[model samples]
Target: DDSLRRFVTFEPRANVAMSVNLLVEPTRSDADAGFIVLQADRAHPMSGSNCICVVTALLESGRVPMSEPETVVRLDTPAGLIVARAACRNGQ
Candidate 1:
């Protein structure tokens, strides 16, 4: 959308060309969260970096509970459901 493009464009640090807009929302009981990746011109495919970033953000921000040793994060993306295993230690 033009609004989204304008929003990202105004961010000095965010490169409008390479920047992607991630729409995160609540999902079914099976998944932790759902996301849709939007690029400047079109909707992009699933991105590994974006997945990692979302997972990390969810865990770090306390949106998803963090468990020591390992935590399973189920992400609902446009491509499909992604199961991410995150290694956690000392609440990190």
Candidate 2:
């Protein structure tokens, strides 16, 4: 898994100590994307920040369709399924 470790490594010059590593699965009918979150070199049960980031990344990147007022994102995680509501404006 050296490749994966290298991929997730944050450049020390950037002042980042660690980075969240997400293994994203193909989009499913029920969920936009499924993923497992890895942090501190191990899998975590869940992370609020990680979930929020995932939702935002999906919508903003057009991985999931964005609605004007709101976007619903379904995330499949190791803990369980998470349904997140994202407030959107001007494609942001």
Candidate 3:
């Protein structure tokens, strides 16, 4: 989907929204998810908000398994690991 990358833009040099990451398959053994961060200028390791978006996308989109109460998502970023617990109700 690199071709679709053009649709997204980073501007004003904001710390939080200056970059974004795309989730991919894990490249390591200890990771449940893998991601690559793309900045306005260059690519980076990770972003906290981007990680949140990724985990949410995975669960909400049914890419990751879900449970009635909670579901744990262990992500592997280029920088390190991210563990997220998502609360679910009515498949949300």
Candidate 4:
């Protein structure tokens, strides 16, 4: 699948620490994105901190736009859908 392909290409060999969040485009209508929480050996469902990380990444990387003071993003995970808000300033 695309998720495994992405993990193989982006993790393990890279310098990134293990158990990082890998965000993908959502396959469901209710979500704006899909995320796979990569660990040293396996992938897990969405976690609180990782969810925050994914949301932050979306806003910081401009994959999702940031609003004046806050940006809301919905993520689809193995567990379920997660909605999050991020603080923004000057598009950061």
TM-score on alpha carbons, each prediction = 0.78, 0.76, 0.72, 0.75
Higher-scoring candidate on TM-score, 1 or 4:
1
Cα shift from native, residue 53, model 2 (Å): 0.6
Residue by residue across 1-92, what tens digits does model 1's lDDT show? 36775566445745555656475774666889887666555566588888888888889999999999999999888788889999999988
Error of 2 at 3 (Å): 7.1
Which parts of model 3 are misplaced by more than 4 Å?
Answer: 1-18
User: Which prediction has more favorable TM-score, 2 or 4?
Assistant: 2
lDDT of 4 by residue, 1-92 (tens): 45663555464554345566777778899888899887655677868988888887888888887887988898999998888877788877
Show the lowest summed lDDT stretch of 10 residues, model 1: 8-17
Error of 4 at 41 (Å): 3.5
lDDT of 2 by residue, 11-46 (tens): 542224555737488355687788766544566767
The Cα RMSD in angstroms, rounded to one decimal, for candidate 4 relative to the true structure is: 3.4
What's model 2's lDDT at 79? 80
* Worst 10 contiguous positions by lDDT, candidate 4: 9-18
Q: How many clashes in each candidate?
A: 0, 0, 0, 0
Tens digits of per-residue lDDT for model 3, 1-92: 55334345433333445566667899778777798877666667777788878888888888888987988988888787878888889988
- Which prediction has the highest lDDT against the true structure? 1
